[model samples]
Target: MSRLSLFAPDNFPLIQPGQPLLPAIVDALTQGGQPLADNDILVLAQKIVSKSENRFIDLGDIVATDEARDYAARCLKEPRFIQAVLNESAAVVRCVPNVFIVQHKLGFTLANAGIDQSNIDPSCINEEHRELALLLPQDPDASAAALRRQIRDTLGVNVGVVISDSFGRPWRLGTTGVCIGCAGVEPIRDQRGQKDLYGRTLQVTMPAIGDEMAAAACLLMGEASEGRPIAVLRGLEVIEADLPATALLRAGNEDLFR
Candidate 1:
């Protein structure tokens, strides 16, 4: 029986702008004496990724078009960022007062195109810096690949990496972490055709283990407290080796909700 533990380092500092998260994480793991091992999964918060990549946007510097302002007025969002997100979005779903669901160019149908306001310096709120607002990486898979390479090079160990973000589920009250990118791990574990104790064949038993691991990491890497933006998940099944997150994405036509 492989057990899961959510490791949180005490009194970690806020990730500064322009800081690389991978090195910090490697240091943390070393300090914790929880060295990365084969089959281990490292779950990281997207905010850290965004911060490391300098993804932020200044609300004041953006000039909102009439259409953007009108939509922002209806959605109750900041016109500048909302407009930018809208411009980047491929499709706009719901545009009610103060809320919107947009499909980004990355094929992710998320709120505000994943634009975030939390965990940013207030002083930069007025600058027109595209670096502040992260454009979804051109290829999340590629990002995961790069991180995996870096981690391997830094630690001299083979391990899995997962980049995650918190997202609200439709009809659900709270949010949970979802894997936006991953490397060296099978994101989904399909159990269909497997038999149970009673010899009953398991069907529809695919588990989003990557998402589950991400959510577990988020519990310790809280949005506010804990300051720990990275977590190490040890003792996973060895089957998770070299697989990426795209293997977990449900086809839009097969999904019932989208």
Candidate 2:
């Protein structure tokens, strides 16, 4: 690719559950005079997608198990929140006071199982349900694929879609965006057998293109209330294959840090 560009349309109404997100995206693009182009990549914040899919939980509805309560006490967090995290995790990875990390059911090593309570409209939440949290979509790959198809049908343009979330690494001081779901793009680009500039054979050089793209788009969509949930990445190379974000997960056997 010669050049890359990323921009978020500045106008969009608050997203709601069960709403057709594609049509609204198209509308916002048109309203901002920025129509979809071929090979354009649409990066969406995971919060909006989860909200649209109605992946919400009321803390009052949770019945914390003994294990959850114990972890909550150790982590100095609420038992209901700990229960939610346990429900979404496959295994507990790390824990400390005010910090709890787990291997998400989807294979991502995420903090608090990616449960979030920020940027949600208070009106949509029930008054009694003060501890409402939004969970990640059940299947982000499927969500991305369905959204891509809808975009294609609406605008007749075959574009890529990436569902991104912010994540903090073990040693990293700050958080950056990561692709939890992607469609119409290669999540990992394998270049193990490729030759270097000096004609030397390369080994173990696979790049996470989806994560890179998501991080680039996140520059425009800030962590705080930027009000820009969708970003369009232009001039990206796209592959017409089912490359899901699951490919980015490191196998348990390959994880040396653990």
Candidate 3:
């Protein structure tokens, strides 16, 4: 690609449960004078997609089991919150005071199963609920595909979609955006047996393109207080790849970190 561009609308609205996302995105883009175009990829924060999908849980609604209570005691968190995490997790990786990491049912090993409490609007939350938490979308890959389809149907433009979430690596200090779901994008680009600039044969050079794109767009969508939840990445040539984000996950046998 000759050049890359990233654009985020300055006035992205605070998303609410069950809200439709496409119209808001289009309105924001049109207002910002950066209308959507063919081949443009949209990188979205997972929170917005979850909110739109109404993937919310009331801490008051949870009834902690004995196992969940034990985990809560160790993590120094609420039993109900721990119970919610336990319900969402397929396996518990580790638990410590104020930190509980688990492998989500979606096969991602992340902290608290990607359930978060930050950036939720209290005004939008029902008064009956004591504390509300947002969970990741049920099927993020399907959500991405649905979004891509919506754009194509409504605007008559083919585009790519990426649902990104913040993740912390065990060896890394801070968290960065990662591709949890994607459509019309290549999750991994295999460069094995390809020749380098000096005509040297290359091996073991597969790049996680989806994660790279998500991370690059996240530089515009800040983690906190940045209202900009969506970003447009232009000039990427990976469109129509139609690969799922699961391709980014390493197979169990190839996972040397664990």
lDDT of 1 at 126: 45
TM-score of each: 0.87, 0.97, 0.97
- Cα lDDT tens digits for candidate 1, 1-258: 657665766555566666777767767777877767776787777777776666655555568899888888899877887778877788887899877888777776778888876666655434444334555555666677788788788778887888888787788878888888888877888899999999999988998888888888888887775677788787666464566777766667887975
Better of 1 and 3 by lDDT: 3
Whole-model lDDT values for every prediction: 0.75, 0.90, 0.92
Error of 1 at 109 (Å): 2.2
How many angstroms is residue 146 displaced in model 3 relative to the true structure, after the best TM-score fit? 0.3
Candidate 1, overall lDDT? Answer: 0.75
* Model 3 lDDT-worst window of ten: 121-130
* Predicted candidate 3 versus true structure: per-residue lDDT over 89-142, tens digit per residue: 999999999999998989888999999999887558777774899999999999
Q: What is the lDDT of candidate 2?
A: 0.90
Once superposed on the true structure, which residue ranges of model 3 sit more than 4 Å away at CA?
none
